[model samples]
Target: MEEMAIVFSPKYYEHNTGRDHPESSRRLKTVMRELKRLNLFSATTGCQLVEPELASIENLELVHDPEYVGLVKRICELGGGLLDLGDTVVSPKSFEVARYAVGGARKAVDSVLDGNYQKAFALVRPPGHHAGPYYGAGFCVFNNVAVAAAYLIEQHSFERVLILDVDAHHGNGTQEIFYDSEKALYMSLHEDPREFPGTGFVDEVGEGAGLGYNVNVPLPFGTGDEEYMKAFDEVVVPVARQYEPQFVLVSVGYDSHYGDPVGKLQLSAAAYESIFKKTLDLASTVCQGRLVAVLEGGYNLGQLGKLAALTISRMADFSYSMKDGTPPANSNVARRARRVIEKVEKAHSAFWKLRA
Candidate 1:
């Protein structure tokens, strides 16, 4: 009955990632602040506030390996040492909160797929993407979006799906999970390999049967609206049209916004609005308005909040506008990224029906 459902739980704070970690509970706190400041909190109407359900191992095994899932459970159960080399730490309650994260995503997917909502956003933390089918990285515990996407495919009987990631860091896990399937297309536009976790290269473009289906647009540092749009126009839109998925999901991370300390690009609220609007256009064309966005990394709360509100407003199809004044364009990255994307366009044109 709600237009949108935003899922969150205070229990996500239990992960206890230790001091000075960028991917802390503080990030979600800021997102919560922004949502409240924008008045998305009223559970009475408009947006729905739903309790997060724990994602069963069955759902998790959709994107993660059974052995890896077992290991994570064992580590959380044993809970005396770090579950990861670093960035990801576990406590006695970690499995609960981590499950909440994945469960929240599933709930969102279910709500959307079941006709309970037009669209939904999962604001749970311990971001996924750096997580892989068998591993975790970049503060992610489990591939939350991956599990939920797989759920949509298996439980909902969907034929085609699109995973769009705008995270500053690449969505390595989502990419790995959906890499070889034409039924699922994973696309990411992120900072170059110069950044950490270092994947998302122009050439990664999925392997084997997924060849050319996986699109990675790696932008350089200081990329602004112009560059972002260029990537969208040249790569994202063109390839996506060919695939024409039944459902669309975005890995929405705010770190690419200007002044995110950990970020390399200089995207602003306006750029985000543009991207969201473009996504809306595509969703309207392909998925019958069935789209979902999950929270990824965005450490700067202020920027994140503005972008979040702007994103929701656009998703709700309100008249879109934003604050102005962007720095000069990073045309160099734009041009270089285009060359790579053009190759993708050529390689995958048969599947996606690229413009000649």
Candidate 2:
């Protein structure tokens, strides 16, 4: 398998968010600038810049509401407005930027479909995972990764797509869209229900035929490096192996980084590095490394810079340094995370044969 990694950057379109917003344009600028300094983007014998193409509304409708899709277009036409409950702002360029978000996802799918690359990373913003089929929340417009997954199902006829969300917050929107389908498995590792947008409880397996397809491992606050890795080994990797997915898509949010303003989890850069490496290894065994990761959230520009570089390097087979030592994993948090994982395993034992 030929391993190639592509980063989709549309920082020029990051114009709608306010100056002080945590998900500001500077976040994208910071990642891009740091990646450049790290030289993973060299034009000579290095990462190639991949141009983005606009995703079709027909494709977008695969995962979003028609009226909601129309509303986004209309709001974008209104020059500037709020899409979410004031968390997401939209300007004339907002629609254009949102298109790039979707575009980057679609392009990544295309590259994989065309046999040009084994792995790709859509380093985009206006982070998704909070937006649903009919509503947008938490600084998101269209559910970019969901749109790509749906597009693959409809057009390419690819079955068995696994969405692995490592965001500190639950990917409620993504879970809602594919909740009742067995063809797609939605799993997430997030802070417990006490956290924001609070909906990912253990009992919320799924409704109808999709029973047991959704897995939610809610880690307690202050969960850091060791706790996160233990959860991965004890839960994430095993569940993924049992699913035997044909393709993998990750919602790679770095908001779990220790110093992130909006996040309470203490996953340091070392923890992030471990997960990145492990996920790539999982992709290798499952989809011949046919995995695509999108930027979700990481507030501290310094931490984001370090984590993003580590993500690119691992997926691209480059070398990098891990932080000296990650924050200590709490014993209480570990106990809580394991309980959550065991409950999920019991719930879905029939589906994926998850071991306790």
Candidate 3:
């Protein structure tokens, strides 16, 4: 088994959202270029680039409504249009490409579960977290990580899957999908929802059996590495340990980086590295290193690829570094982040043992 596997396909580039669009083929192109420049596929890195198969309709229906799945297919077949109101543009080939993206995510999970790799990262495009059971939005066409988690439970008969979303925007769709179930715990750390998709507030914890399973840490704008790491240490790590997930999945989004144009939070590449390393350690502690990360957001073409490559290197335990300027310290932002973390801890205290 390789140390890590990267699920990607050149075909992901065919899903054209538009040349000028933030979620364009250029993003993947840049990421691939950086991966190659770093020699990530070399044996020394113990990483292999694996192409993904198209996801079957049955697999898609595991999470999404059949009608919604068919709608996306039909829309793409009819020469592609917007999957959502405006941002989620699709082309004639987008349906297939989106399936390939989902396929890539699933492939990553399978690779880790099969013991072929300790961990895997699905570097496909057309991000998925914004899409839900019946709709796609925010440049997302399908909930790739959601489907992967559902697949692990339904197909593999595994329970207790944990999804850790570090996207700058809340994965409202992923949360909604699993909001009523205990099989999957959805935790997200993102900018305040008032600034983005307008959801994932601290009080919007899960319902029914999943009442305490949904964890959201909505930070203030200008939050940097220190605040983010503190949230991970105080809130994320404790909740995750209590859940004791059988497998871990991360919605890896780099838009929170200080360089990203789409997101408002200020996170340095080093912050992302620390987050990834912490996630890897968390998985190793709870799930024997069974983890898979799927691409969700990150629009800055110049920095997206470098961050993606850095994440892959971290997964492979390969040493690679890049500096994308630091975010200035803001004591005010740190205080706000602490408040949010405290609220989140209080909100979920009934569900998990958050404090000693």
Candidate with the greatest TM-score versus the true structure: 3
Worst 10 residues of 2 by lDDT: 40-49
**Which regions in candidate 3 have their CA more than 4 angstroms from the true location?**
none
* Model 1, residue 149: C-alpha shift (Å): 1.3
lDDT of 3 by residue, 1-356 (tens): 24898899999989988768988889889999998988788888899988898999999999999999999989998998988766799899999999999999999999888888898899988899989999999999989999999999999988899999999999999999999999999999999889568898999888999888898999998898888888899888888888899999999999999899988889998888999888888888988999899998998988998899889878888788987778679998899998888888888888888862
lDDT of 1 by residue, 1-356 (tens): 23887788898888777778787888877767877766675653377677788888788888888898788878878963465676677667776787889998888888888888888888888888788978877888898888887887888777678999998888888888888876678998888755577677766777787777788777777777776777788778977877888988899988888768887878878888888888878988988888888998888755666677778777765443557468776667667656655765666665566654
- Candidate numbers sorted by TM-score from highest down: 3, 2, 1
Model 3 sits at a Cα RMSD from the real structure of 1.3
In every candidate, how many clashes are there?
1, 0, 0
Comparing 2 and 3 on lDDT, the stronger one: 3
Give the top-scoring candidate (lDDT).
3
Q: Candidate 2 lDDT, tens digit per residue, 54-110?
A: 767877788898999899889888877888766777777777777788888888878
State the weakest 10-residue window (summed lDDT) of model 1.
Answer: 316-325
Question: Model 1 compared with the native: what TM-score?
Answer: 0.92
State TM-scores per candidate: 0.92, 0.94, 0.98
Q: Model 3 clash tally?
A: 0
For each candidate in the order shown, give its overall lDDT on alpha carbons. Answer: 0.79, 0.79, 0.90
The deviation in Å at residue 196 for candidate 1 is: 2.7
Question: Over 4 Å off in model 1, which ranges?
Answer: 43-45, 318-324
